[model samples]
Target: MPLWSLWWAWMAGALLLAILEVVAPAQIFLGFAAGAAGTGLLLLFGLPGLAGSLPATILVFAVLSLIAWLITRRIAGVREGQVKLFNHDVNDN
Candidate 1:
């Protein structure tokens, strides 16, 4: 019961973030949700040394969150066409 609690926390955090992402479309919360969910899956596998160190766990979370954020930005920032520019002033004859 106690050991599984940590994974539960991660899973809960992921779900919360996913909900937030839907409520607010900032495109970042989804990334966070992905990171948290991935971390939770990792922790579930009983990785050595990851579950023992608080600092390492926090660092991993931060790194994963950052990576997720970057990937989200890259995917969401795509542009297909160039903006039109004009040198003439409007209403000028």
Candidate 2:
């Protein structure tokens, strides 16, 4: 198959995996989907050669996922603290 077609396939597969991840609520496939999405983005940018691109994309996705997780954790922590303050009054009733 052609390179463009293969790229589209990868993107479609990534979208499907993301949807499945949502349905199953497992974080595993999300990484793979993120990697595929990164690859698709690279292809969209007209990056030459597929040899190094896939691995690079995977690495990028891994790093990004880590950062996102950390940020989410921080946000959740703050939200939890806020909830406690607001909920204390409700608990008295």
In model 2, residue pairs whose N, Cα or C atoms come closer than 3 Å (at least 3 residues apart or on different chains), thus clashing, are none
How does each model score on lDDT?
0.80, 0.63
How do the residues 1-93 of candidate 1 rate in per-residue lDDT, one tens digit apiece?
Answer: 344337668889999999999999898898888888877877888767777777776777778888998899888854567457788989888
Q: How many backbone clashes are present in model 2?
A: 0
**Whole-model lDDT for model 2 versus the true structure?**
0.63
Expressed as tens digits, the lDDT of each residue in 1-93 for candidate 2 is 454335676688779979997898656667667666766676667666653555654565577556645554565435534653454665585
Candidate 1 regions off by >4 Å? 1-5, 78-93
The top-ranked prediction according to lDDT is 1
RMSD of 1: 4.6
